[model samples]
Target: MRNLDLTTLRSFVAVAEQGGVTRAAAALNLTQSAVSMQLKRLEELLGQDLLDRSNRRIALTNSGELLLTYARRLVELNDEAVGRLTDDVYEGELILGAPYDVIYPVVPQVLKRFNALCPRVKVQLRSSTSLKLLESLRRGEVDLILTTEEAPGQGGETLTEMPLRWVGAQGGLSWKRKPLKLAFCNVCIFRAGVLRKLDDAGIEWEMAVDSDDDRSVEALISADLAVGALLEDSVPPQLEAIQSCGALPDLGIQKINMYGADSRKEVLGELADMLRQGFAASRGPVAVPKALTA
Candidate 1:
């Protein structure tokens, strides 16, 4: 009988999530050569190659993808068991970062649940864009982050995915206006996708309002000051999805991700589980546009 080692599995998962052996080594506090050897050993044990080394960036083989799902769960369960056996009470400070606008309907409730589960654990939240949150994570400023990915499977572990659609005030013809007015955060990841889609479809647009404040952008959309692009599931009640906007291209699905720091695997894993459950439970009707589906 062959025994699968937890240490090797941890290295394999770190490589997959970090996107390279070098990054994984840094995160795992191991040498790059050691990390590579661990992966080789794991592959030999499984009798299959797990990674495609053809390109400069690492990508998972089909077998690799299949194992990743199980690997993550196994590692999580292993850590959870150890933590539960070692400590009945967990007390520590965790700094969490997230975009103010995207944290709703899920994050707040996740934090509430986390607090209840680990009453002595102190949590400090920092509101920032995904870009900034990732930087903070790297800088050791934030222990975990809930962030939005501009495209599906692009970055981070996706909690849920929703399409981006045009939105305008209910009963308003803002979408029909020429040089279609828009409002959004200047640093928003959706901004590039929104512009690229419009440009590719030969639709003219102008930025009418730009701010970091989500409420301001939503206000602009609500008052017919401009049309906006947002996740289908996140469209405001005062606004409606605009399906007939001329020649507008679909902004592909955006993923909400839960990213955690390299340390505190047990705590982060528990929080991640809670986040996934909370989002899964709260997910409402998806509002994909008809044309996009076609």
Candidate 2:
């Protein structure tokens, strides 16, 4: 009956995600009473109960679940519209997210160029694992993200498929008889694919080191502690691809992609073109830095 407020919808989504008033309050940086009052106001306006609050934990009612889905879409659309109108001057903040490995190699140059083109724009960068970055995107926290594509079910468009290669300290370890000393990120798609291939080949191997951080894995490989798989374009300067590994049986290559809410299609489209150009320029016929070459 009454027009819903955007702030109330945001609060509702936060509560749904956190599953309790206290937690939701903490996440939204609002007092528990304030959050509860907003939830109550939302339910009153909608003329239906959103959550079943009889229990300790908040459980979304069927209506709440439906509203939660629509609420996220609505918020995304609202934010995109606001950003577009405000961004005509290219003077507002653009929050971008990507894996450190991808961004560290060429993003500085990309940002430098982007800033020169849109000097008034303020750019903010956040680096994290692909999964975490995607979560941030869905939460409406990031304007755009660059990440590796997984199987078809995973969200995001496939921009480029670059080869994956095994790299380790130069001349430090030989793979003749020893099970390869492997280093990898815990949930890395590239690492998972590599491990799967190794299992299928019946290659005796053990994880000499594991971390969720890319820098840590790179450090291990650089120190000759273990071998690691990386995008052909992202191998570090201190390491060399292991010739014995022999092209890694394809590992299906790693895909780089861009993602944002559909409502931000205009902004995402412009951003995507810029990224495609950057990737092509970096990976094209012109030579890239040795650190970036496979």
Candidate 3:
């Protein structure tokens, strides 16, 4: 049986994502001709035309689109296997700051993958509000940080974007109250934006709880005392995303951005790449915390 080459597959995936062979070559650190040759070889081997070259910009053909899905997964799986098995070791410590809202379901995966790649590189994770994290980054107190913002800040690389959500008790009626009561961390990044959105909608709001502790806010929200805003996937177990269905104004989208790290360092660059992959990975469904129902 004929086999597809992983190297060529990676090039094809890059070209598809980067939008051209030259761009892919630069990204892969391979010559343009070399990337072109790999793409041709892959196409010949498959006996299918994968790219539509008739247009000014190359685009994926139906077959290429079909192949891209599998290619990404295969490439990711291969890289993961190598990272886990390789004995490559690097020693260093990097301080990483991120907001509490986005620490789960992505950061854990990134840390695990980074550990496999650089077992000796100590990464100290500090969780705070986004505004505070950005401040720490500016002060050089943290080597790198991730921020949640409506728009990415200067020198920031956005990893992913999700819609901001109004979250509250699963079966609560607080949303029905006028001058909607809100529970937010003292330095929560969403506070300003959410308030603006509410104001633009001509809705009045009152702060029901203001504490630096996330659990304190969550606890109050869980009791139907107040509501809060968060990114869609960041909503906690105790609080469910409010299906406002027009009852509440939309809080808009939030971007998860990386800032304050120079990619010149190999390990730091790898960590950023890992975060990119981690955020892109499939997150099937959010599970209900059993404790919530118990």
Query: Which candidate has the top score in TM-score?
Result: 3
Residue ranges of candidate 2 with Cα displaced over 4 Å: 1-88, 104-106, 150-155, 245-250, 261-268, 288-294
TM-score of each prediction: 0.62, 0.61, 0.68
Q: lDDT tens digits, residues 1-294, model 1?
A: 988899999888767755566656654657889989999999999999888777654578889889888898888777666655544667778888877757776678678657656666788989988878888877878888888886433336777777778888998788888998988888877888788888888889999985888788889999998988877766778998888745567777778887773355677776777776656544543222110100
lDDT of 2 by residue, 70-161 (tens): 99888666666665565565665778898877885457756754654455577799988887888888898988888876543345766566
Candidate 2, residue 284: the lDDT equals: 39
**After best superposition, candidate 2 residue 35: deviation in angstroms?**
58
Show the lowest summed lDDT stretch of 10 residues, model 3: 285-294
Model 3 Cα lDDT, one tens digit per residue, 52-107? 77755466778888998999888877776776566355568998888877888678
Model 2 C-alpha RMSD to native: 17.8
Candidates ranked by TM-score, best first?
A: 3, 1, 2
Task: Quote the positional error of residue 230 for candidate 1 in Å.
Answer: 1.2
Best by lDDT: 3
Clashing pairs in 1: none
Q: Which residue runs does candidate 3 get wrong by more than 4 Å?
A: 1-89, 282-294
